[model samples]
Target: MTAPAEPPRFVVMGPSGAGKSVVGAALAERLAERFPGLRFVDADDLHPASNVEKMRAGIALDDHDRMPWLALVGGELAAGADGRVVACSALKRSYRDAIRAACPDAVFVELVVPAGELGDRVVRRPGHFMPASLVASQLGALEPLDGDERGIRIENTGPVDGVVTRVIAALDAGW
Candidate 1:
């Protein structure tokens, strides 16, 4: 008989300030409790120091600046022995494609939030390299998941627990 299918890797994706890191961590925690072999990572930690410095100065990253970082993120997910949930902006379709190229089974969880709320969230967040001014650029760069992509899009405006619950439900439903 065939071996059981491997658990899916999760990419918690969105524009900046959509709570990818928090939600991804929560989702990974719950999934690990059930799956027993799951890990969570924030993609920002994979960024190069130059990229961090650029964002800290309110500079938006171009594809040239992001490609290498995306490769590292994808490599980390692909190399893991257990399932992984990663928080990444993945702002463009091309960026997602790059990740998929390395980890073909990567499933995205696109977090949606209003631009105004995103701006406010970024402004209130301390110590993050990304500035509130870059929210617009991130929003502009965002490409919503395509109909054919393996993922779900959920609104993240409500309570964090509620959002995590919905995401877990969707993953269970194989959406």
Candidate 2:
């Protein structure tokens, strides 16, 4: 028999400079067309002022600063339509775990770029509090996806369509 369809709980995650937003938007469009019932939620808008303050000051946030925000994102995921894309910077395993604790079927897609590319994007891109300098701190905080049961890593190094195609291929591969 054909396998049971994959459960739908999609999260796009990675470092700030990794282009999660772009891919998530593309994914959202694709899913909305294909599944139509899918919903897309960008996690950036949910960031609390505290996170904003920390990032504004160029201070890397610790998990303590992330718990409430994580919970809020978690709630959003739990409450989402069965087919949905959650665009978030879920950098660490613990954080992703927190999300899964709320919705066990969640799938994480890590949008990644090389450090140099990340820096270039951050510097060239206009009007974002996450400075290029924070790349190091963010890299420091990122846990490799290898150890996680629910992670898929995709490089966000080229055009949006190309990256989205790669992501879609990865998703098709079932991580």
lDDT top scorer: 1
Which one is best on TM-score? 1
Q: Record all residue pairs in model 2 with backbone atoms less than 3 Å apart, i.e. clashing.
A: none
Instruction: Give the clashing residue pairs of candidate 1, or none.
Output: none
Q: What TM-scores do the predictions have?
A: 0.96, 0.89
Candidate 2 lDDT by residue in tens digits, 1-175: 1122653677899887788777897887876666656778888788898898889899888889888888888888777444668898888888988888887878888887888788888888788878888888888889867654676788787688888788777777765
lDDT of 1 by residue, 46-92 (tens): 99999999999999999999999999999887876778999999989
The reply for model 2, stretches above 4 Å from the true place, is 1-7
True-structure lDDT of candidate 1: 0.90
TM-score, structure 1 vs. true: 0.96
